[model samples]
Target: MNEALHVVCPHCDAVNRIPSARQGAGPKCGQCHRALFAGEPLELTTANFRRHLERNDIPFLVDFWAPWCGPCKMMAPQFRQAAGDLEPTVRLAKVNTEAEPGLGQQFGIRSIPTLALFRGGREVARQAGAMGAADIVRWTRGQV
Candidate 1:
């Protein structure tokens, strides 16, 4: 029997149970009826960050960034591209530290573009720098 995975919807933040085999088959959110993986990084805020971090059965990669930081701005495109390359299997998201300062403080994000990878509600790996799309994918894959 195939295992079931808990996937939080990017559109409505609803939790959906997806069978492992059908994850790549373009699953939709049960509540919102929207595509689960939209080939882009989900914008996470204080309201929904904890839910996604604790609920997703798959690995979650979060890019902690701020608007005015030059490195964060430079890495935004790379992170977006990495989301496309890593989605469905891995959930990619971005948290703007300027807007969600509390979350930044909670996570102890000292850098502007820190990449944190979480699995099963805990951090598995962390990278404190900007990276290209390939490196992001490679590093994340290596971690999980």
Candidate 2:
């Protein structure tokens, strides 16, 4: 029997079971009928952060950022490109610290453009600073 993996839908926040072999085959959400991996970072809010962290079986890379931070703004596109390169295997997301101060505090994010990697509902690795897409991909691959 093929193993199934739990994937949280970025659009609707619903969890779905996907065949492990078909993870890269572009699965759609059963609840919202939207593509599971959109090749872009999902905007994580206080309301859905825990769900995404706990539900996804794959590694979750969250960029803890703020709108007013220049480095965060500069890293946005690189992070987005990294998402395209890492999706279906690693789920990339962004948390705006300005909007979700509690989450920032919970994660102890003292700086903007911090990258936190979570697996099995817990943080495994983190890096603070801005990096290019290749660097992000390389770092994530090494860690996970």
Candidate 3:
């Protein structure tokens, strides 16, 4: 039997099953039908962030960032690169602190560009700072 991996449809948020071998080749979402990552960060707002966090079976690396912070701006690409490198193994989500102050308060985020790693609906670890892709990868490796 072919092993299937579950990937969420970025368009309609439906679950899609794909052959595991297609991980690197990349695949389109099955529902609304769009490239899952499609060169964009997964969007999270106060309304749906908790739902995604709780329901996602995979570990999530969510960045708490805001638009005006230069450090956060500089780390955006690195975050995306890390997301790509760690795809399937790890999922990435983003929250704009300015936009979701309540979440920031809940997480006790004191700085911009805070990285939180969550698994099984609980926070496993967190760090605050800007880092390169390789460094982020290393940091995540120790998390699990």
The CA lDDT at 28 in model 1 is 96
Off by over 4 Å in 2: none
lDDT of 1 by residue, 1-144 (tens): 999999999989999999999999999999999999988999999999999999999999999999999999999999999989998899999999999999999999998799999999999999999899999999999999
Worst 10-residue lDDT window, candidate 2: 105-114
Q: Give the TM-score of candidate 3.
A: 0.82
Please list the residue runs of candidate 1 whose C-alpha ends up more than 4 Å from where it truly belongs after superposition. none
Candidate 3: which pairs clash? none
Q: What is the C-alpha lDDT profile of model 2 across 14-34, one tens digit per residue?
A: 999999999999999999999
- Top candidate on lDDT is 2
69 Cα displacement, candidate 2 (Å): 0.5
